[model samples]
Each structure stands twice: as C-alpha cells, then as structure tokens.
Target: MAGKAPYIVPVGPIHPALKEPVHIELTVVGEEVISADFTPGQTHRGIEWMGLSRNPVQIVHLTDRICGICGVTHSLAFARAVEQIADITVPERGDYVRTIIAEFERIQSHLLWAGVAAHELGFDTLFYLAWRVREEAMDAIEVITGNRVNYDIIQIGGTRRDITEDQYDKIRKCLNTYKDLFSKLKKLFLEDAVIKSRCVGTGLLSFETAMAYSAVGPTSRASGVTADLRVDYPYCAYGDLDIKPIMPTIYGSDVNGDTYDRIVVRIFEVAQSVEIIETCLDNMPPGPVIWEEKVAKILSTCKKASGEAVGRHEAPRGEAVHYVAMDGAEAPISWKVKASSYSNLHVWPIILKGAQLADIPVIVASVDPCLSCTDRVAVTDNGSTKIFTKEQLAKMSYEKSRRMMQ
Candidate 1:
C-alpha cells in the first residue's frame, strides 16, 4: 500500500461526465480522489469581445445567446446596466414583467439541472420525469415571450413584450401545475434511497470553504451562505417582493453542504420562484412595459451616455453581474460579464477532493456549472493556447490600461 503509485485521471475537453467542455485533472489513489483541478476556458465564445463592437441595444440580443437555459438572465443584466448609464427608469409594469419571466427562467433552469443530475446518478426514469415537468415552464415562457429558447424579450430600458390579461390565465395554469407537481418532485428527488445514498455525504463543501471560494446561488445557499441578490441587493421588482434565500435547512435538516444539500436548495428554490411569480402577477401594475418604445431613441440615449455602472440580477444559478462603461460612442468602451458559474466553479477542486471516482459525475453536475456563460477570455498566440498566471494577467491588464490611456 505504501508503494502504490498515484494515477492521474483526465476527464474531458469532451467526456461523457461533463455536459460542457472542461478538462478536469484528478489525482487519485485507487478509487478516492487525492486532489482535483479543472480548466474552464475550453468553450470560450468571446461574447464580450463581440459586444465591444455593438451598441447596447444590439448587445442586448447578444446577451440572450450567453446561456441557453437562462434566456432572460444575461439580457436583463445587460439591459439594466445600459439603463443605468442612460438614466432610463423602467416602468413599474416593466419591472413586474422582468421579475415574472426571470422567475420562470429559474424554474426551468433548476429542473433541467435536476434532470442532468439525475442522469449523472444513473436515475434515467427520474431524469425523464424532471425534463418532462420542465416543459410546462417552457410552454409558459413561450406563451409570454413567443419563444421556447432565447426569448428576446428584454430591451435596453424595459421588455419587448407585455403580459396581457389574456395571457394571465395561461401563466396561472402553468403555476398551478407546478404547485401540484412540487411535492412529488421533492419526494422523488429527496426521499429516494439511491439519491440519498449517493449524494447525502458526498462532495461536502463547508460554509467556510464555500465563502472562501466566493460561491454563489444554490452552491453557496447549500453551504448556508445567505447571499441572494434578491434579498441582499434587490433589483427589478425584487425590492417589492418578500423573498429570502433558500437554504437546505428548509428541508428540516442541518446544513451538510454536500451534493444533496445543493439538490435541496435548488428544488425548494423552484417553489420559491413559483411564489414570486404569483405575487408579481397578483400585484400587477398597469402601465407600459417599455420606457422608450423607439429602438432608435434608446440607441441615441445610449450613444449620449458617458458613465459606468454595474447591473446585478439574481439569476437562476446565482448573482449575475454586467459592468458597462460608455463614452458617447455607438458601442460601450467596456462591457464585462460575470456569470454566477464563474464564482461557483472555484469550489470544484475543494468539493471533488476526497470524493470517490464513481461520484465525480454527479458531484460535478451538482454545481450546475454553465461554462459557456462563465468563460470570457481565452488567449491563443499563433494557434497555440496560453495559460497565464495571476501575476502575468495583472501586469498585462496594467499595460493594456496604459496603452488605452495613451
């Protein structure tokens, strides 16, 4: 046993375990993981680089393509940033509409993640059931935004579409369906023996460690960190809604900060999203959904805008932020995005360490890492990829700033 050699196991760039292209290096002693490391820039799309050449109005549509599951997340965040820079106040009805659609996005995203998690754990029947139920949310999204995926409903100052009274009944029906299905979903995912056995004590992340890594969304909530942007820093009708962060303790269990706890947090958050949507609908304020109806006017305002501001939203994954700086130009001088997965991905090595090799898939899936949204920069020199150290990146950033100033 003393002379037994450690093995280096590589998973992905393209692996069955990972939904996205992320290379994970695991140092293992037999079945147990000794240490783990992951590289995320494998799927960088350069969305930010593209945004620098487009106006805020054009960039809003580009944001929708950031993540397939989070249809409104990026657009909403980007819109809010541009709105802040242009000093455009969204109408009350517009705020309510944004909140409603964002909650629906939460419902579908969580269910999709649940299905993936179930599939990773070899629970194909549960996987099928989860995705099947998720369609109701998708249908409701289509009913409101007229698209199942990439709902281009968000505008620079407000929404492109409004939830008319005729659409109310359809939305309510979908909410009622989820209300009925919620309990069954809880029982099937939480009370099942196999799920409990595989996920209960596996991939534990302590609150201290989670905070140290700056985890967000369900990943942090599972670790008992009460840091929901909806509660901490309310935006887009969240200020009017009475909502708190969902913790695993809601399940009548202490915070274990394991894969199961993450499951519990997300499952309960789906119910929370349902309540939030219902509340927004009930208190629906009557007004125009867009601040400026003319796209040309919105563009003109953005072009005249000369300031910087950050837009933060409690996306399904966690807090998504967009920083925008404009200087009387057609495009922003700077546009940066920080998706929730960026924060959560840092915890992978911590959680994967000491975990069994068999549990890698579910554990990785548990965090619900959206690498496409997280990856922003990928440096390649003449066809060769480059991985820069922290110090090197810092120095390069400083040099770039100086060149820009000159």
Candidate 2:
C-alpha cells in the first residue's frame, strides 16, 4: 500500500453527472484522491465577444442565453450596468419585481442542484421528488414572466413586464405549497441515514479556505462565511426586506462546511426566498415597471451616455458581475462578465484532496456549478495569442455559417 503509485483519472468533457462539459483531472492513489484540478473552457460560445456588435437593448436579451437556469441573472446584471451609465432610475415597482424574480430563480436553482446531488449519490427517489417539487417554482416564474426559461423580462432602464394584481394570487398559492412542504424536505434531505452517512464529513471546505478562495452563495455560507451580497450589499427590494445569510447553524448544527452543510444551507435558503417574495408582494409600490417604455428613447439615452459602471447581483450560485463601458455609441465599447462559479471553482483542488473516488460526483455537484456561464475562451494560433476584433469574429462566424450551408 505504501508503494502504490498515484495515477491521473480524468472525468468529463462529457459525463452523466456533469450537466456541462468540464474536464476534471484527479490524481489518485488507489481509491483516495491525492490531488485534483479542472479545466472549464470547453463549452465557451464567445457570448461577451458577440455583445460587442450589439446595442445595449439587443445585448440584454442575449444575456438571457448565458445560462438556461439563471434566466434573469445575466440580463439583470447587464441592464443594471447600462442603467447606471445612462443615469436611468428604475421605478420603485420595477425594483420590487426584480427582487421577486431573483428570489424565484434562487428557489428553482437550489432545488435543481439538490436533485442533481441526490442523483449523484444514487438516491433516485429523492432526485425525482426534488425535481417534482421544483416544478412549482418554475410555474411561478412562468406565471410572472410568461416563460419558464430564458425569461426576457429585464430591460435597460427596468423590467419589460409588470406583475399585475391578478397574477399575485397564483404566485402566493405556489409559495403556500412550498411553506407546507418545507418540513418534509428538511426531513428527507437532512435526516435520512444514507445522505447523512455519505455527506456528513466529506468534501470539507474550512471557513478560512472558503474566504481565502473567495467562495460565494451557499458554498461559502455553509462554511459560516457571512458573505451574501444580498445581505452585505443590498440591491433592488432586498434593501427593504430583512434578509440574512443562511448558515448550517440555522439547521441547528455547527458549521461543518461539508457536503451536508451545503445541502442544509440551500434547503433553508428556499424558505428564505419564499419569505422575500411574499414580502415584496405585500408591499410592492405602485409605478411603471420600466423607466422608458419606448425602445427608441431608451436607445437614445444609452447612445448619449458616456461612462463606465459595474453591475453586481447575488445569483443562485453567488455574486455575478457585469462590467460595461460606453462612449456615445449604440454599443458598449467594453463588456465583461464574472459568473459566480468563477470564484468557487478554484477550491476544487483543496476540497478534493484525500476524498474517496466514489464521493467525487457528489462533491463536485455540491458546488452547484454552471460552467457554461463561467467559461471564456482565449484563441491562440501557432503558439502566439490571437485576439479577434468584432469585425474579424463576425466575418469568421459568417464564413462558418456559409460552410455549414454548403
């Protein structure tokens, strides 16, 4: 056993457990993982590059495609940046609508991840149950935005759609269902012997390591790091609500920062999100959903705007930021995105050390990573870096389309 050699084991680029294409390389001695690393650019689609040619109005819709699950996250962040540069003040009702949608996104995302984690652990019943319950949140989202996925509700100044009084009854009905099922969910995930045995002490990330590595969302909160952007720096209706970071302590357990704690944090967060949406509905102010209703007027304001600003939102995974710079143009001169996964992915090597090979799937799924949202590509030709301009990229894309047609 002492003389056993460590060998590399690669997982993905394609795998059943991974929802996206990411290659994870593990160096293992027998069943114990000695070291691990991951590569993330396999699914990069040049979204930021594409935005260079589009105006803020057009680009906002494109942002919705960055991640299928976080429908409003990217659009909201991008719109906020444009709003700041254009000096647009969102109507009070718009902010409340934004907050409600964002919390609903959190509810669906956490539930989806829970199902994935359960499936990774071979708990098919739980997996099916978790996904079945998640439909309620999806229905609620559709009721508000008119689409279940890739909701194009956000716009530059504010929201494109408003929550009508008639819609409030259905949303509240969904909330009431979750509130009733909260205890059963807690029992199923936290009290089950199989889940507890498999997750209690595995894939540990200490508080210091989480902070040092800049972990975010439930990943950091599980480690007892009070780093929620919603609480630390409120935006939209979050400032008006009594929001607090959900920790393992909320589950009546000390912070272990293990896979189990991550589950605890997310389950409790669903309750927190419910409370937020209900509060927003009860006190939603009366006003326009968007600052400028006409696309021509919004575009004109953006074109005249000349400044730089960063928009940050507490996404389901963590803090998602969009940086935009404009100089009296239809399109922003510069745009960049930093998804929450970018901050949490680096801790893989630390957390994976000494974990059993069989536990790798659940450990990886515990982070609730969305690699498609975080991936960015750097082109290199003949060993030298190549940075393509918007025109060059467009030409190449057109050529590729022509070739495909042939």
Candidate 3:
C-alpha cells in the first residue's frame, strides 16, 4: 500500500441522466471514495448583480427568476429589501397576503423536494404520489396568484391582487385537503421498512459539523441545529403565527444524521407550513390588500430613489439572504444574493464521506439543491422546460375568476 494511487472520477455539468448541471469530482480508492467535491458548473447566472443596476420596478421581475421553485420567496425578499430602504411600512393586509403567499410557496417547494428525494432513491411510485398531493398547493397558488411558478404578485409596497372572501374560502378548503394528504405521506416516509432501510444510517451529518458548515433548512435541522429564520427573524405575517421551528429528537437508537432524519424533518415541517397558512387564512383581516395610494405615489414619481437594506426569507431549501445596496439615485447600484443552498453545499463533503456510490443522488437531492435554470419547471435545458408567458398568467387569472362564478 506504500505507493498506491487514488482515482479521480469526473462527473459533469451535463451528465447523461441528471436533470440539472453539476460537476462532481470524486477521489476514490478502488470502490471506496476517499473524498468528493462539487461545483455549480455553468449554473450561476448573476441575476443578483443585475438587480443592482436595473430600476427598482424591473428588479422584482428579475428576482423572480432567481430560482424556479422559490420564485415567490425571491420576489418577497427583494420587495422587503426595497420597502425597507424606502422607509415604507406595508399595510396590514399586504402583510397578510405576503405571509399567505410565502407559506403556499413553502408547501409546494417542500412537497416537490420530497418527491425529488424519493425519485433519486429509485422510488418512482412515491415520487408520483407526493407530486399528486403537491398539485393541490400548486392549483391553490395558481388560483390566488394567476400563475403556478413566478407569481409576479408582489410589489414594493404591497401585493397586486386582493384575496376576496370567496377566494379565502377556496384557499382554506385546499389546505384542509392537503393536510390529510400530508399526514398519510408522513406515515409512509416514517414507518415504511424499505424506505427506512435505504435512508437510515446513510449520510450522517453531526450536529457540530452542521453548525460549522452553517447548514440551513431541514438539512441542518436533521442534525439538530436550531436555525430557522421564520422564528429567529420574523417577517411579514410570521410574527402573528407564533410558529416554532421543528427539530428532531433522539429516538431508540443513536441519533444518526442520515437521510431518514432529513426526510422526517421535512415531512414534519410540511405540516407546520400547512398549519401556518391555515392560521393566516383564518385570522386574515378585512382591508385593502395593498397600499394603493402609496404605490400610486411611488409609481407616478419618475425620480429615482434608493437605499441599502438586507432581506431574508425562509426558502424551502433554506434561509435565502438578499443584500440590496442602492445609490438613492437611479434604479439600483448593486444587489447580492446568498441562497441557503450556497451555504449548505459546504456540508456536502462532510455527509458524503463513507456514503455508498448508489446513495449519492439520494443524499444530494435530500438537501433540495436549487440548481436554477433560466426558466421554471416546464422549461428544461433540453428544450423541455415550459414557462408560461405573460399572456398565459393572465388567462390563468381569468380562469380562476370563472371558477368562483361556478
């Protein structure tokens, strides 16, 4: 063993089967991997920097494209940043709408992530089942926001559309349906022996290591790291909900920070999201959904105004931090984004060590990596990505109105 050499296996930014572009270098000694490295490949698009130079009006749209799954979160974060800089206090109704929309986005994102994790583990049936339930959240969002992905509903001072009494009822019913579905899904993920066998004791991320890497979301929660922006740093309607961050506890066995724990944490969090949304809907106050006067005043002014502010949102993947610096002159001078995935990526090596080759994708997907493309879910890089044009979002809005008529 004195002069033995290790093999460097290079994976890709465009692997044959992977849906996203990632470059992974695995240093292996025969069948066992000694170390591993991962990069975004050609994924970074610099949308954040572009926000800094564009007018504040356009930055909201640009921010929407930061991540397909977390589009609403990005928009909200940017809006919050701009609102803070302009010293604007959004109306109470605007706060409620923002909170409702954010929680809806969280529900869909977590469900999509659960399905993706299952698909990576070769559980195609489970993937389909999870997505089936997710459609409920998606349809609710489409009904409320006029689009499934990039809602384009959030504006600087308030939301664009107001939630009517009938629309509120529709949302509550949808939440009820999803609550029952998620309960069953949680049982399957936790009690199923087959899932437990593959997931348990795989990818052990210790609590200390998680803190060191500054892991975010369920990935860090699985390791018992108590970090949640919703609780620690409340925003919008979160302060009213009294939501607590759910953490895992040691069971009968050793606290193995494996795939099982990650799955459990996400499943539990999904329920928490559902609860939060319902609370927002029930306690929703009656007022103008937006600060119409304030918005009209800002839009009418052609003069440029700017300031510096930082906005953070609890994205499905983790805590997404957006740093906005405006010169108080033109649109904006610069914008910077630090997504949770950016930080969680550092924890990969620590968890991946000693994990089996077959478990690689499952473990990676469990972290809910947001390898953002130019478009949303429909528009794949292989000409398969489907994105709704402006016209389509408008049409969807009309359809929702028609549904209410029925």
Candidate 4:
C-alpha cells in the first residue's frame, strides 16, 4: 500500500469490457483500496421489459441481442423457457446442434478473454497470439451460421440451421487447430513467469466466498466450486454428454480463485468446449433441425401457450437464466433475465478488498463481467465522483511494476 491519497476515488465509469460500462467507487488507503462499490446498468437495453410486450417468436430475436459473445446462449435460454411453457420437445438432433453451437461460442469467448487477460498484464505478444488463434473459431462459426457473432441459429423448438457435413469438417479443422496449440497455450498461460506474478495471488476469491456469493461458471470453478449449469441443471444435450467443470487445482493452484486461476480455468474450458463439440457432432442423429410444423403456426401456438418456466444456459461467462410466464396471449405475461454478471457482481467487493489500484483492472476482468446483460443503475443528483485518467492508471501500474522490479 502506498500513502493515503484521495478519500474516495472512482476507478471506472468506462472500461475495456466493451458494451459493459460500469462505475466503481473505491475508498483507498494509499494505493490499496480499502472498500469499493460499483454501479452497473449503464448498458441497459430493457430487453426483458421489451420481451414481455412481444410474442415468443419475436422475443427470440430480442434475447439474441442481449450480448454478442453469448447471444446464442441467451436465445437458447429463452427458447428453453418458451419450450418448457409450451411443453415442447426438441428432437435429439436439435439438442445436439444447440450444444455444438454453444460450445463453439464458448471456445471463441474464452480465447477473447485469454487475450484480454494477457493484455492486462502488459504481455502484448501473448495477447496477439491468443486472438490470432481465435480467428479460426470465428471462421468455423461463420461457415455454419453465416454470421460471426449473432448466429441466430437456436429457435424456440429447434435450430433454424443444420450442421451440414462440410461445416462439420470445417469445425473439426478449427478444433484441431486449437488442439495443436493446446500445449503451447498451456505452457504460455500457465507457466509464464510474468503471468504467474501478476495473476497467481491476485484477486483471490475462496470457494466459500464464491458459493456465498452464488458465483457460477469459471469464476467459481477457478475457486474449486464445481458449479456449472450444464452439469447441475442438465439442460439441452448436456445431460447426454459427460460434462466436467474445470478447476484450477489441476495446475497446483490452491483453489484460491485468483485472476491466474480464472485464466487457467477459462483456457481449460476452451479445451473442454472443443471436446464437447466433437462429441455432439459425432453423436448427432439424422433429422430435420427445426420443428417445421411448430414454426408454420408459431404465433398461434405461443398465443395459446399459458404457463411459467425457467430456462438456463451455460453461457461463455457463466449461467444465463430466464424466467418466463405466458398468459395464453401473443406476449409473455412476465419475463426476467438474470445474466451471469448479476451473480458475479456480489463477489467483487470481497476480491477487491485490500487490492492495489494497479490490480483493479485485473480483478474486475477476472470475473469476465458482462454488464450489458446484468446491470443496475444508482442515480444521485449532482453526484461528485472522482475520475482517473488512463495516464494516471497506467502510471500507477508502471510504478508498481518498477517497484516490484526494484
């Protein structure tokens, strides 16, 4: 900790977590943050509120725009909810197809996070390498869905597109490319001295803390909390696959959910996603992708659908859950979206306690937060919030690094 500076300093009203604007108020004692509180909801799109006004068919498209990284998963979750309400049964092929696309999204998202994590610690080389490899996944996804980010593949009862043999081959090639780099990625991310120093003991979140805060996905997995919706809730084709959550303990980490552990867990998850995608492709049964009869009369069916259901998808970040209630009308009577970022926000204060100003970005990014999906606003009239410029933040990190070197 350095000498006590300002009494109350705001670390962010903007961050590199694009479309994920957040404001964090940090109370500092010198350079070490003594306490912190954050403001979310800066990216509020009111998708949930708007969803209630639309029919299930229309809401499907709305959910897809919730977050680009996990857009498919959000729509999948919405579809699951609607399907449950309508007592709709997706074909085996549909289930497998959904799983494949979700896993591919996971692989791509984890690579994105890996690159961002490397960049946070001033390792631009690794950052470039990770993203350079991510291009392959994007290519494969485009080949399958005709779009890179928002595939819009998962419809209510089934997927709108089928995985042709040629696309499957391309996917395999992409996975193979990732597999070939596994050893190199494994070494670079896990064993690199600089990565270890910056991340190993930083942003520590214990398993107990994770559970207490209801953390999910890699955030909790990094802390050895085996909590994953794909396993726990067993939705879609995850029940058929032998799903295993990745924990950082495998790398001799103390299960002390630090930024480093988060990195390891996300990287391991990319490998796991590849395996799951391969399994899904191999075992997919031959059938039409979407329920043609249902789509032909979708509006009529949803207008008559009356029930409540919960949908859960293991998004790239964590669990993207939606609760839906239909009142036998063209629109849902009520709908609520709880993205992973909502659950993840609670754990931040715990992890950020006693953390240095230089570590703020690392700790915040560790959770893979998606404020766009889950955020709330706290408004105050004529609020006086202190701001730090990039130059100031960078100088703080550089000074800390210099001191560490000294």
Distance from true position, residue 165, model 4, in Å?
1.2
Q: Which residue runs of candidate 4 sit more than 4 Å off their true CA positions? A: 1-6, 15-19, 377-406
Measured with C-alpha atoms, the lDDT of residue 6 in candidate 4 is 59
C-alpha root-mean-square deviation, candidate 3: 9.3
Where is the poorest 10-residue window by lDDT in model 1? 388-397
Top TM-score model = 2
Pitting candidate 1 against candidate 3, the one with the higher TM-score is 1
Count of residue pairs whose backbone atoms collide, per candidate: 0, 0, 8, 3
**By lDDT, is 2 or 3 better?**
2
Kindly list the per-residue Cα lDDT of model 1 for residues 1-406, writing each as its tens digit.
3667899999998998788899999999888898999887877766887788898988998999999999699999999888988999999999999999999999999999999999999999999999999999999999999999999999988999999999999999999999999999999999999999999999999999988999999999999999999998888899998888999999999999999999999999999999999999999999899999999998899899999999989898999999999999999999999999999988999999999999999999999999999986777899998988656866887898899999
Instruction: Report clash pairs, candidate 3.
Output: 52-334, 306-328, 378-385, 378-386, 379-385, 379-386, 380-384, 380-385
Answer with 3 or 4, whichever has the higher TM-score.
4
What TM-score do all the candidates reach, one by one?
0.93, 0.97, 0.86, 0.90
lDDT of 1 at 361: 97
RMSD of each: 5.5, 1.4, 9.3, 9.7
Order the candidates by TM-score, highest first — what do you get? 2, 1, 4, 3
Tell me the deviation in Å of residue 299 in model 2: 1.0
Q: Which 10 residues in a row give candidate 2 its minimum summed lDDT? A: 385-394
Q: Compose the digit string of candidate 4's lDDT tens values, residues 130-188.
A: 99999999998888888998788888788988898877778899989999999999999
